[model samples]
Target chain A: MSLSALVLHKNDNVATAVRPLESGDSIDVEVADCAVKIVLLQSIPFGHKFALQDIGWGERIIKYGETIGQATASIKKGEHVHIHNVEGLRGRGDRP
Target chain B: MNFMGYRRRNGSVGTRNHVLVFPTVICASSVADMISRAVPGTVSVTHPHGCGHLGEEKEHIIKTMVGFCSHPNVAGVLLVGLGCELITPELIAGEIAKTGQRFEILSIQAEGGTNATVEKGKTLAAGLLEEAAAAGREPVDISELIIGTNCGGSDTLSGLTANPAVGVAADILVTEGGTVLLTETPEMIGAEDALGRRAADEGIEKRIREITSATEVLAKRVGVDMRGSEPSPGNIEGGLTTLEEKSLGAVLKGGTSTVRQVVGYAEKPTEKGLIIMDGPAHDAVSNTGMIAAGAQVIVFTTGRGTPLGAPIAPVIKVSSNSGIYRRMKENIDINAGDILEGKDSIKTIGERIFREIIEVASGKATRAEVLGHNEFAIHSLGLSV
Candidate 1:
């Protein structure tokens, strides 16, 4: 059986929580078409995002291979990425 | 894909043939309302804006009045104004003239009094009613349809079901060559990068940033934390924990189409593929902006349910949660509950919505329309008139 979550792109540093995911639970992630195993570091609610890689403080968080926001706090791989850490960066224009 | 629609003199198809009595200033609203009430199939929007404003604010009210009259659904327009107001009836008529639409004006001062203006307006509106009645539905292409999408009373299911379903419908309409507009600037705050990636070109992307930043700076100056103000209490109770999370769901209403153009509040879109309008997140105000942008029809997606509708446009309400569907059956038109229930995919429900749009455009009344829900509001820049 496949995991209920989906990671939209290889370059995306985040994966979408299609289903409620619990901390320490393992799921298969197809990064760049190569299947890799990653365990959740925290409970991720449905429709929320989880980090695909280590996110440094103040670094932009990439999802769908685009910067949706920046990490207000450092996030380790497989941890939930949301308001507890990431915050929207205002004033900076979008990259075309 | 064809529907029978009333064809206007300017070659635009109207799903509804309405004789509208629009007030150019707050001073003439009561008189305008009297005229609308005296006539059937007429609506008068009572707004507090239109006086004591300068520059763009004044211009926005004038343009919005004209756009409402030129809307494809309106067969004829009767403008009511105080002769000395910044937005006079003549100026309103002048803007309407650009659309080649049928319009007439009545000025209270010029008419000698409110009673006189009302008497003249009623007479003029009566004649316009007959002219509107003469126009009948003709075969119209789907591409000619300009649709607006809005989401309100959002919950976690909104992004997961209703919003994404709207996205699907938006994508389908664009593929069919129809125009779709996405608005509510504040709701797009945490998700600008995602929208920029969908822009038609570099310029369109830049425009999105400029408009979004402008809204943020304006909100900051007013001492409101825009992001904190997002995800209303209802939204938080329904499972959304952050503004960014809410925005991710909010942006899904546009589907995955390329952004064709960006417009200011009440500015009509010149390009026809997909556009974003600068609008507030409030239901009535945002709906007004969309209607002013020439949207002949609106698809309002809700997870917690809303009873909002535009006076001139037919608003088709789509409910994301089954509980809301059952509870607010009188207000909702379609149920996107299948996505939440895991019975059907988002694409399937989206196609269902697309079909519903065609049906509504073809003269089938929406639940909101049947309930006679015509709530109108305008976004103000906090300028006390």
Candidate 2:
């Protein structure tokens, strides 16, 4: 399906869903010169983010050509990426 | 471009001619409030500090008080004190005298009691208000205006729509030789690299990194992850995922401009163009700092919706998306949400915001002003004792 989503930068690993997206919906997204299709693994609310490609555990999640956070768990392409799965690497007072 | 403004004897311009009821300390806030309420044409500004501060914090408080008293927006001031407070009216007066501001001081202790002080304050405030009413706005160059930009209650659309739209307006003002300010130091975290590239010189670039690092140090020292406080509950609901993401989006309100100077909290910029005021991200505290730093008007962008406004300056609210704009139409002045639906582009919405700024600067009361949102707060050091 043609997706209503935005990938802010070419180097970004995630795309923001412009509208509510449901599981099983396949989205075709183009970031820079590359075009790819990924099926959603979980329901995503409007304005939320989804991984454009598989992100390894503890790997940096890029958006706007910058690291927004690091993944807390392995994230599949098209899976929801939010607080539960992504943790900020900066200002991490919980860690020593 | 020019807007009609109140020309002050001190060689500054005022968008509003207000008689200010100023409280020197927390103990005098109620009396100050009472005085402003009793007098017509006066604005009340009260804060929770006036004692138990030392060194730089005390200096910041004094600077803020002097800044507000000498502010171009205020025509006259009635300074209220509790006599024993650490920040005495005499000290404030000594500073205001240099700025040539007309003021009167009423100490509740010296006046015998609250009732007596309030009575005397009413008389003093009334006189100032009467004098203020005679002043009229004259045509002034737009470059004389110092516009402060702040973003709060942001969402995903903030980066895409309202923030950048406001950025365009900021650039317009800057290109016209006017001043624009980018504040909320903590919000610059993830966008430091992008922002540093636009710094005017090596000193500014160094300051940018220092401020960003300082916020991280503060977050770590406090033991509460900034992400927890940032990307707040409303932000999560609106699709903001993390502090880095939030910072990246929030800093876009500055637009792409050459950073001219970096001033301390509540310190006015010496250089014009796009200056950075180092302060926290709290809406009220940040707004107060900007206003105290000589910002005559504030262009506040929000996606989650806030009715926050300064006690003095006009806060022009711009919504990042249509939902919040419709939900809080009474509070919001302009809607950039049309960009989401392709009804408007960022440049067009920015131009619209720029026009609204001119109208507000030329004496149009914002929705917040009409609704009476006179909020004020001081950024203080955490410890009270």
Clash count for each candidate, listed in order shown: 0, 0
Once superposed on the true structure, which residue ranges of model 1 sit more than 4 Å away at CA? A1-96, B109-119, B225-243, B381-385
Model 1 error, position B72 (Å)? 1.8
Q: Which candidate number has the best lDDT?
A: 2
Using Cα atoms with residue i matched to residue i, what is each candidate's TM-score against the true structure? 0.83, 0.86
Instruction: For all candidates, state DockQ relative to the true structure.
Output: 0.13, 0.29
Note the residue pairs that clash in candidate 2.
Answer: none
Give me the TM-scores of chain B across the candidates: 0.94, 0.96
**What do the candidate models score in CA lDDT, each in turn?**
0.80, 0.86
Residue-level lDDT tens digits of model 1 in A18-87: 5688899887766675777779998988767788789999997765455667888999999988667776
| Model 1, span B271-384: residue lDDT tens | 988899987888888888888888888999997898888888999999977889999999999898766555766779999999988888889999888887778887775544
Q: Where in model 2 is the C-alpha error above 4 Å? A: A1-3, A6-15, A22-44, A50-96, B225-242, B382-384
Highest-scoring model, DockQ: 2
Model 1 residue B239 CA deviation in Å: 4.9
